[model samples]
Target: MNLETHEPVAENLGVLEIAALLRELTAALLDIADFDEALTRLVTVAQRTVPGVTWCGFTALRAGEPAGVAASDPRLAELDDLGHGAESPAMSAVHRREMVLSTDLAAEERWPDWTARACALGVRSVVAAPVDIDDHVIGALNLYADAPDALTARRQLTAMLLAEHAGLLLAGVRGREQRTALTNEIDETLLQEGVIGQAIGVIMTQRGCPAPEALQVLRSAALALSIPLREVAERLVVTVSRSRGA
Candidate 1:
């Protein structure tokens, strides 16, 4: 195998070789926990496994615009930014929810401006495959090469398979992140409620009032002070602690 190009020295990859490549990809990404880190790892894997790929990047749609989310190299990130518009292969793949291939940027007529800019940046061939998560077209995986026609049929297939795997992994990462955030939010809410309950009890004892009347007084104080109920409750609790200590 040619390490630089990641291609077989004498022939295309056999079935076993392809299986090995897939196993490598799965092993590399299975342990990632963060969404951004997963995307970074994905691009790194693309550069190592895709034949003739000199650079790799991931682009995500934000507010209906393409944004470079990750890259195997810093230069690839800059290259991804150039494709933010409709003329870029990454944008096209995301919009069409399919793969877009440019065999030679110099001879490409479909996106003249993008081709010109890519060529100037030493990108001669490109493959962009849409990444889908839960039936939604979320972004694109881009493979770039410095030699014309380098992203051949086999390379395109590899890119597509990688994109599919990335989508599944990213979806799991996102779900876990969301669950963690929700758990934290719930804990915070419960803590705040406990503080408010303590404040209400303090008010009841100090003013010789019922629980409902104490709560009403606290609400009135919060309204007059133009502060949140939680803030007022926290302040009251802290003041009582200080007074008891003194």
Candidate 2:
């Protein structure tokens, strides 16, 4: 909830241009119905505003579970081609609970196997920080440039701030999903309960039984039919009502 005061996002560029792009980014994130589209807009804004970053992207994981991102960056169009369960050296760094940087994979030894793959992909340097919330690591934020000097203290700090914002937005999205699921479950339960109550009433009137006896009849029928109690109740209610009408 830290609303960091946004100064003029553009210092050297014209104020109008900066304002327009900032406004565009804000609109895209707020108005876009697709979460992926919103994150794409966010990545675009980060890359355009930040210096020395040839690539910038965010990874989203589900409910603090271990997940991977098919990160979107113009530099690595092939990233989208990676099949499931693929990993990059940069991703391993975030998984290891540390910020990782490789000045040159050709000579670096930190992520030996991962570095070789990255070098083949034309990435000379990479820096990544973990995306986390409430003390749980969800994913990672990664940046890469062809040059070794692509990282700076200012740019790195900005990247961390952006990752924090990503975490908050992700948490909100997950909360909304949970609320929707609960609402659906409640609706289904109400519908089923009404049907079951109607069936119990039919049994009571037809068999001259007490309420608990009627319920037992329904339970027995459900077991015999090998169906849900609610489904059995619905069928019994329909059958009894139809016979009365006839």
Candidate 3:
């Protein structure tokens, strides 16, 4: 929230440069449709736009299992190895719903195995921020650098903002998808009702049965055939039309 407070990192661009980069990144985010694609695009953008970010990745809970879903570089595949049981910085950020920064991975002791592995991969520092939307932590964004103390306070703020932006964009995309699905369901229901009503009318005209009796006939045929009433109604309507043509 306090974008103006921290001192700029030496490895990073000036304030105006970062602003322009953020604008371009937002444009890229808007252009993406799939959530997985968006996450991959975001990590790639972060590695390019954020200073000293050698690699980037995101960890999210998918189908109740925690896993790394995206990474900017192939080397960052180490992220995927951090299974749900791994106590890595990304897990910490998502669990705490806050930022987790480590300036010297070699000396880090919180997660010895993770730190050692990252150091072996030439990653000396990292910053992880939780992607939170609607007061819920959905995932974590992680940025890595090969040098010590690379992710300064200013860059951390920028990373946090980027994570928040990603969360908001994801929420918007999901909302639109849900609305579209609901609309499709409603259209299908109305179409089925109309067809079934027409079939009932046909039965009444041909058999001289009341509406209730005609509906019972349709239901009975459906149950005998182990199918839906709508299916029986649809078949009746099609058959009567074909008979008239004959």
Candidate 4:
């Protein structure tokens, strides 16, 4: 297959060839453990596999705002930044939930400023495919080419396939990160509760009071000192331990 031209290599790719390509993509991305690394790998793979793709980038929503997450080259990230406006092809794909293509930046009228800047960076043609990470998170896979009419139907199809795979992999990575964060939070909460329980027990023994009364005394001390309940409990436990050691 001619990797530089927009012409279709064949009427349709053979089933075996499609499967092989998919296998290659899966192998390349499956072992990635970090979300940012996975996004970086995705753009790298797109640049490697897509025809006429001089540079590639991935942009996604971060903390409710769109940001450039990864790029095959640093320049591509700069191009992505220019693509945040309403007329930008990348943001258009994300907003329209479809593919957006610009055959020639010189002739492009919708995004004059963006095209001017992209042309200055040697990008003449571009394609952007929406990557749906989840119901809530949508991203764009942007492909840039140095020549006009570089992104044909066949090339766009390849870009879309890569974007679909990226969505799945990124979603899995994000899910794992969220789960790990939740598990850590739970563990910290349990540990704090245990410390507080121990502190309450100490107060109960020293004051000859029930658990509720001991807890109230601990709260009163925390309020008076203007410290957190957890800090108060930790200090009391440490003080008691040191006294016993002495």
How does each model score on TM-score?
Answer: 0.68, 0.54, 0.66, 0.68
Ranking, lDDT, top scorer first: 4, 1, 3, 2
Q: Which ten residues in a row are the worst by lDDT in model 3? A: 1-10
Expressed as tens digits, the lDDT of each residue in 98-214 for candidate 2 is 665555657888656556656777777766666664344376667777677556544555555566666566555545555767866764554347888788778888899976678
Which prediction has more favorable TM-score, 1 or 2? 1
TM-score, candidate number 2? 0.54
Off by over 4 Å in 4: 1-17, 62-64, 82-86, 190-246
- What C-alpha lDDT, on a 0 to 100 scale, does residue 91 get in candidate 4? 79
Q: Write the per-residue lDDT of candidate 4 for residues 15-80, one digit (tens) a residue.
A: 464566667767777866667777888888778876678999878876447644788989757667
lDDT of 3: 0.76
In model 4, the clashing pairs are none
- Best model number under lDDT: 4
lDDT of 3 by residue, 41-141 (tens): 87888888887789998876644466337888877667634562468888788777788888888789988878877887888998888886433327788
**Which stretches of model 2 miss by more than 4 angstroms?**
1-44, 59-65, 74-98, 134-137, 190-246
For 71-100, candidate 1 gives per-residue lDDT tens digits of 888865755674444668887787777888
Clashing pairs in 3: none
Cα displacement (Å) at residue 178, model 2: 1.8
The candidate that achieves the highest TM-score relative to the unseen native structure: 4
